[model samples]
Every structure is written in structure tokens, then in C-alpha cells.
Target: MLRMAAILILALGAPAAAEPLARELFGAMAKPSAQAPEAIGTYARGCAAGLEELPESGPTWQAMRLSRNRNWGHPEMIRFLKDLSLTARQLGWAGLYVGDIAQPRGGPMTGGHASHQIGLDADIWMLPPSRVNLSRAEREKISSISVRTEDQTSINGNWTRSHHALLKAAASDPRVDRIFVAAAVKVEMCRTAKRADKAWLQKIRPLYGHNTHFHVRLKCPQGSPSCQTQKPTVAQLSNGGDGCDETLQWWVTDYLEELRNPPKRKKPDGPPPKSAKTYVMSDLPRQCAAVLSSR
Candidate 1:
């Protein structure tokens, strides 16, 4: 009886053994399919860096925290800060923050759905008032009082030429996946970036937009479980669908027409898709069932 009791106590005190790798495989697959191996790796690295830079408990972190219902992304924020440091250094700006971090509650403009929910969004401060171009001076003055309270008037009026430059520089960065700026600012920055660096321009243009405050999104890193593979959508040809030959001709004609006269501003029809939904599962392929069962 004593020996049996000792064995029971010992068993109860011992830690459970680590689950087999097969269990880990099942757990991994149970998550959203968008989670790619490469993306997951990137996310892990990003999260580690974010944790180091951002304290788990603090006023700054609390203020920046997203609603509990949303999926807050740490890795994205880490990459943003890393990239912003480089951008600010090159552009001669002090730093980037959503609002005036110095003023406690002071942060960047927030209205509509900025990617701020995911910790990836940031509102960079515009250049000092003195440096703003006189020709566009009227456009640059943002009412500080109105901005703090989430006023739309203040948001629309506050954008400046310096802000445009900062956004342009950020958008041109290779790591930037997309940028949403005010329509007017997008046009100006797109044109400037295109002239300065054609490759960056091409990459950034498709992701461009005009909103009150600029929203910056970085590319899904190499190992994010949430990242999805995407391809440009083409209308599927049906029995009498728009034929390929006709579509090709139409594209050629439209391209030539646009080449002749470029507009000052172009608005997107709607917000861009935040993530790709399509997925290809390696483990889920036909041959996997036998292998999985054997194991």
C-alpha cells in the first residue's frame, strides 16, 4: 500500500511529456489556412522583436492596444518600427508616431479603418510648419485641437506637403506592401516617386489610395501563418464571355489612350482586400492520407 501510494504521488507530481510532432502538425493545420510556413517564421521573428521593443504592460502600449475582438499583429508593428527608423534617418525627420507621443494622448490621425488595429499602422508627423511650401501652404495647416478628438474636418485639412514627402519615402521602401494616402497626396507622391525611382513607383502605385491620414501596410513576411498567396483576378471566360482576343485589344487601346493624357487624380473604387483567401495545403494533398494513417 505504501509503495503504490508513493508511485501515485510521483506520477501526479511529474510533468506530462511533450506531445509528439504529429500532434503539432494537427494543431498547425487546425489554424487558418492562410498561415504559411514562411509567413509563420517571419511572424515569430517579428513578434520577438516587437516584444523586446514594446513593453507588455505600459501606458504607451495600453494607448496603442487594439480592441480585444480584433487580431492585433505584433510582428507587423516590429517591422514597421524597424523600417521607420531607417526612413526617418534618411529623410531627416525626428521619428514616427501615431500622435504626438510627447503629449501623452497625442498620436496620429485615426478615423475609418486604419490598419492600426493590427499594430502595423502608424501616423507619421508632417514636417515643421516653417518648411511647408508657400504655394501649398494652405493645404498643410492641420488644426491640432480638432485632430485630438477624431474630427474629420481636422483630418482632411491637416495633411501637408512634408507629410506627402514622408509617405512617399515610406511607400518607396522595398518592404512596404501598400500605402493609403489622401487622394491629392497619393497623386503627388506617386508622380514624384515614379520619377525618382521607377521600380519603387511601380510597386507602390497599385497599393496607393487617398484617405485622411496615411495608412502604411508592410508585405507579409516570409513565415506568417496568416499570409495568403494571391494572383491578379481575371474574369473567367464562359460560353459567351468576353473573349480573350477582344479583352486583349481593349487593354491595348486603353493603355494607349492613358499614355496620351494622365490625370491629376484617380480614386480607387473601394478599399483594397486586406489578405488573400486562397490557400494550397501541402499536407492536405491526396497522397497525405496514407502517410498520415500509417504514422
Candidate 2:
């Protein structure tokens, strides 16, 4: 009897098997929570409730990679994408080829992003649609063209005035917070923009690996009190001026040089930082538990 008791104590004292990662839990959900819509934390660390799915195909847009089922987003994002697709028509393109927005419940995804966790971000393909009626097979096989050249120093022939007009219209929208594109594209826009009409250029930020598509992030919708708004960048904080200066030049110059010859550094002597893939449920906002468990 004493021996049996000792085994029971050991079993009880042993740590429980680890809970699955948050991305695994959220990614398994194929539907949004049954509660009212809310964005519950920062873009990189949060979950959303009551997300709506964009239609697989629309009159002016088509959601790509339907197999991923990542076309879900907050209603405001759906409206914004539809509106932007219509705007693309004015530039003589058929419409936009919409990319991933977020998973149905908007938590850390299984792969492919660090953000898109709160349902206000989306990817718009640089490849304008020749037609919005692409077969599912065609979308999977097709690819977007890079506006910048392979060297990353300048815009290639694929970049056009229509692309400029489309980007300007998007950045000028009151609902948008910022747009991310390749650095070279921003430099070209800065060069060609009229001095009197350059205010919207400030929203066009340069980031690495956006040569094939641009990312659009929207402001928090009016009703989401728990949503965390992203802070402005240093360029945006500087007197509301268009970001057309030396800082922009660094991407093609010093940034490229570092990329070509990366400097070695000592590894930090601790556990690695948590990212979307590494996050567990506790790493997300408390309310995410409700979002994840809700039917």
C-alpha cells in the first residue's frame, strides 16, 4: 500500500504535458468565434473575434491561396479591400489580387507572418489582375512580378505610372495607416511626385522583401476599445513632412552593402525571443482564451 501511494504521488507531482503552441490551437479553428467582433491586442500578438471572410471571388477582386483559408478579416478590412479593388479599375487594371489577411480567428498563424494577428492588415499583389475570374489552380501557379530590379537599386520596367497612381490613391485613403513596399519603389515615388502633392508619400514605408506585393495596414475600427494602435515611426513624427530624405537612401546604399556581406555577431546567452510561431496562449492577451474557445 505504501509503494502504491508513492507511485501516485510521483504521478501527481510530475509536470503536466506541455500545452500545444498557440498557433496550433488557432490554426486548427476553421471559423471565427460566435461573439461580437473585436481586435484584442497588438498586431503581432493578439486574437480577433467575429472575423468575416472576404468572398472568394468578387466583381473587381479575387482572393488568392484559397486553400490557406486566410482570407478572413474584420468587416472594415473587407470593405476597404473591396473599395480598393474598385479604385484599381480607374487605373485600367481589372482589379487587385488579394492575398492573406488573417486566419478565421486571427491569432498567431501556423506560418508566414509575424503580424496579421488582429485582422486589420492585408497584402495586395503588385500583379494587377488581367481578369478577376481566375481558376483556383491558376492562382496557385501564378506569381506576382517584382517592380524593383534584381539589384534592388531601382524600379524595373514593370513599374509604371498606373502603379504609381494606384499606390497614391491607396495611401491617400483616410482609413489606411500605412503601406509597405520595396525601398526602391518609395524612392521612385519620391522622385516623381509633384512637390505640392507629396503628403501621401509619408505613408509609403520601405521594408525588406516586399518586391512582389505591398502590405496595407488599417487604423483600428471605431468600436474596438481593446485594440492597440501602432505608434508612429520617427519619419512620421518629424513635422508631418513626406519621408523623402537621406534615410530613404540608406536602403539602397548601406542596407544593400550589409546584405551582401553580413557581419558576424555573438549569439545572446539566453533563450531566444518569442515570435508568432513560438507564442503560446499565455503570451497572447487574456481575452484570447475566450476567442479561441468560443464556438
Candidate 3:
């Protein structure tokens, strides 16, 4: 009787207060806020203001997945994409098939990403474009090719010299912070690149699920004082070397070995960690609420 009364008292003491998910709030916004452009927090836990949308069709590029409404980015990012597409044209390809940049008002997306909450990250499809005039339906129907082999040991026939040149050019750019590609792609590039021309390899990081599209993250542009830079900068992470030796080898060797022979471990006793999808508005910076509420 006492336990029941206690439970009843607790239940009746206060009303249930369930805050909505941040992604829901941000995702519901159909347009950017009317404010000066700024990146407000870390890539995975922030919001952007005054983001510009990349045109769906440009002379040198086409933004795919029109249904996702994720072609928006900062002005600097837009300029960089345009410049890179032009470089693609100069390299004998029609142009780039640009993938997701960010949502209209950059924040935690409803789905399909965890780090594009800022307007500085972009995904460039691996498939070299034959044409940049793809219709909305075509963009949705098409899929990018995997540059790596099925076993993930090395690059496939689709990995061409033009790809190497394009990635090298992107990594060498001043605005770029880092580029993420499959481990095999990095290994192949490392093997073929000349010693003197390999400095940019440090910025080419190896990540999983990037065989179809390489991700590019740009440095915080000028005027975005609130933008937080990624810690342990590329130079620091690489220890001033090109990271072509042990780091690249680990992916194919130990990583693959671990995958084949799974290690046994005890699960921790706790609730699951919070991710972009689970975040509430309070998990982000104070400025984000203002950005969300802005006119």
C-alpha cells in the first residue's frame, strides 16, 4: 500500500515534460534564417546561419538528390565546389556530381548523416560525370560506383588516373581541412605518388563507406567567429609525416583481421550514447536556439 501511494504521489507531483528532438526542430525549417552567415558549433552538434544553396544545375556540376534538400552550404563552400568542378572540367571529365552539402538551415538532419550539421562538409560522388544536366528523376535513380574492390583490399579498374589527380588537387587546396576516402584508395595513391609530391597525402584520411563518394571538410571561413575547429589538426594527427606507412597498412591488415576474427568483449551497463538523431536543443550551443528561432 505504501509503495503504491509513493508511486502515485511521484506521478501526480509534476507533469511529463518531454522535449522534442533537435533534428525534428531543425529539419522542419524550410529555409535559412535571416542573419549574417555563421557556423555556430562543432560539425556534429551545431547549426548554421545564412547558408547559400548550390544551384541544382551548373555549367560544371550538378547537385544530386534533389529530394533531400541538402545542397545548401556556406558561401565559401559554394565557391570551393564551383572551383573544384571547374578543375574537374580541366581534367577531361564533364564535371562533378556533387552530393550532400548540408540542409537549408544547417543543423542535425532528419536522417542520413551525423556530421554535416555545419555548412563546411560536402560529399563528391566518385563516378566521373559524363554530363551535368541530369534530371531530378535521373539523379534519384542513379547511384555512384565503388572505386574499391569487393574485398576492400585495393582499388578496382574504375579508379583511374583522373581520380588521383582530382583528389590530389582537392587535398592541396588551402580551404580544405581534410578529405575522407576508402582506405584502399589512400593506399593506391600512396603507392603511386612521387615522394616530393606526397605532402598533401596527410589530409587524405581513410574512412569506411566512402568508396562511393569522398567527403570533403573545409576549414572555418573568415567571419564565422563562433565556428569551432576540429581538434588534433591534420598536421598534429599525422605527426608532420604523410601517414602513408603504418596508418594505411593497418586498415587492410589488422582491421581486416579483426573483422574476420571478432573479439569478445563485455557490454557496458548504461543507456546508449546520444547521437545527432537523439540530441535535444539543450545539447547544442545556446546560440543554436537563437539561430533556430531567428526570423
Candidate 4:
């Protein structure tokens, strides 16, 4: 009986170390490629492995907010940025100013973004980049301006064709799954883009609070069987749009009403603001935990 009790106690005490919350583990990740490059799970509910950091500067582009240490992404996303930077200059833009890509292991972000949990999403500032060499302090000090009016009714004086050209270059990329921008930016695109370039309009998705920068997400890389792709949104599922559609009209109506009367935002329904349950490790794919555990 004594031996059995001792065995039981040892068993209970064994593996007593608590598992770290997913957000906590991911947040603490300092580097990438702890393992092979593998994007696992859905965007909001996913994590990635084998992440690589983007170079701080290139011939035509420079990254910002380096202190965040979010200039990392999957190899495909890094390549996409490299190609897009070159293309932007050729498309007559001065250069590109990139923002966050992903954290090293790519899990639930403690700060901005409900997505970008995988290595496929990135944010590029709308601020035109004329100079490729910007000091860390300057990069942090400079702010991107919203193209929307103060009232948010429509594009403001800051809106220019240069913005359109930059967006077009990003949307035109075949590897790009979608680009999220403000409704006003989409409305402007619908009004101005020539018919020949309208196919790219399908990839430009209008979402809230992207007036100062555009969000770009890439499609799953070929041969990535474990990577989950998103289902088609109503916009993507419904075919055939030259950008002039009821969707755009609805956005305009919504914008007008909001300007006249902004609705109150509801508090989130869930565990308290910083509850550990905020990021359920099991909610992510099994592979993600493995990614975090690797070197």
C-alpha cells in the first residue's frame, strides 16, 4: 500500500509543469524557423512555423515599426514583398512602405489585428516612400495619413491617383488573395479604374479602418496541404462585379448614416479583457503548439 501511494504521488507530480497559454508562448517567441516553414490552421485561428524576417531595407522599399519585431513572415510572403517592391517602382510609385507581417511563430496577436495569425498577411503603409533610407526614430515618428474625410464620408484631399496606382500594383499580383482597404478607396477605384484593369477589382475587399494602410493576404503556397484556406466571403462567392454594384452602394449608404450618427460599439462578449482563455491553445491546430515548442 505504501509503495502504491508513493507511485501515485510521483505520477501526479510528474509533468506538473503547466502548459503556457498560446498567446503567451507566441508572444514570447523571439525568432523564427524554430522548425520547418509550415503555415497551419485558419487565419484567425492559426499559427505558423519556419518564419523568416524581411530585410529592413531594399532598393525600393523600407520596413517600419521595427521595434514591434513583426517584420517576419513565411518565405512566400517575404518573396511577395520583395517582388511587389520592385513592381511598385516600375508602376511609377516612388517606393513601398511596409508595416507588420507576422510575429515569429504567428499566433494570436496581443495588440492590433484579429487576423495575421498565420504568415500570409501583411500591412503596407499608404504613405508614399520616396526615400529608402529612414532611421529607426524617423520610421517610428512618421505617421500615415488617412485618405478618408474627417467625417469619414468619402475620400479626402489626401486621396490621389498615386494611391490608386500603388493599390493596383498590390492587387494585380497573382499570389495575392485579397487586399483590404477602406470603402471610400474602393469607391474611388470603381469610379476611376479603366475597364481593362477591372478584373483586379475583385480582389480589392473593402473593410473598416484601413484608410492609412492596405492589408494584403496571400493564397496558400502550393504543396502546403496542412494550410487551411479561407472560405469565399459573400463578396467573393457572388461573381461578376466591375466594382459598380449594390455592395458599393450599401457601403456609401452606411457611411452616410454613420457620419450623421455614429453607432455605439458594443463591448466584446467573452472572458474578461485579458483572460487566459483569450487564446485557447487547442483552438489552434496541433502543429502550432509543436511550432512553438521547437528550438
RMSD vs true structure, all candidates:
15.8, 5.8, 6.5, 6.0
Arrange candidates by TM-score, descending. Answer: 3, 2, 4, 1
Against the true structure, what is each candidate's TM-score?
0.39, 0.92, 0.93, 0.86
Q: What is the C-alpha local distance difference test score of each model? A: 0.33, 0.88, 0.88, 0.78
In model 1, which runs have C-alpha deviations exceeding 4 angstroms? 1-72, 99-161, 191-196, 203-211, 229-295
lDDT of 1 by residue, 1-295 (tens): 3323323433455332221222223212211122212222121111111211232222111112222112223454545554664555455544443321111111111222322322344444333222222232333333222111132112345554556556666756666655544333433444444353444433232122234234555565554444332222112221222222443344335543564566577776896532111111121222222222221
Worst 10 residues of 3 by lDDT: 1-10
* lDDT of candidate 4 over 1-295, digit per residue (tens): 3323323443455342333456666777788846778778777778888988998888888889988888889899999998888877876766788999888989887678778888999999887777889999998899887989766558988888878877887787888888888988888888899977687888888788898999999888875678877778424644755556887777778766886798998988895543323665655677775676666
lDDT by residue (221-274, candidate 2, tens digit) is 987898887886524553588888777888889998898899998999998888
TM for candidate 3 is 0.93
TM-score of 4: 0.86
Off-target runs (Cα >4 Å) in candidate 2 are 1-17, 233-238
Runs in model 3 deviating more than 4 A are 1-17
Model 3: lDDT equals 0.88
Better model by TM-score, 1 or 4?
4
User: Over the stretch 1-295, how does candidate 3's per-residue lDDT look in tens digits?
Assistant: 3323323433465332245677877887778878888887988889899999999999999999999999999999999999999999999999999999988778899999999997999999999999999999999999999999988889999999999999999999999999999999999999999988888999999998899999999998898898987887888888988879787889999987887788998997998788898987667886777677766
The candidate maximizing lDDT is 3
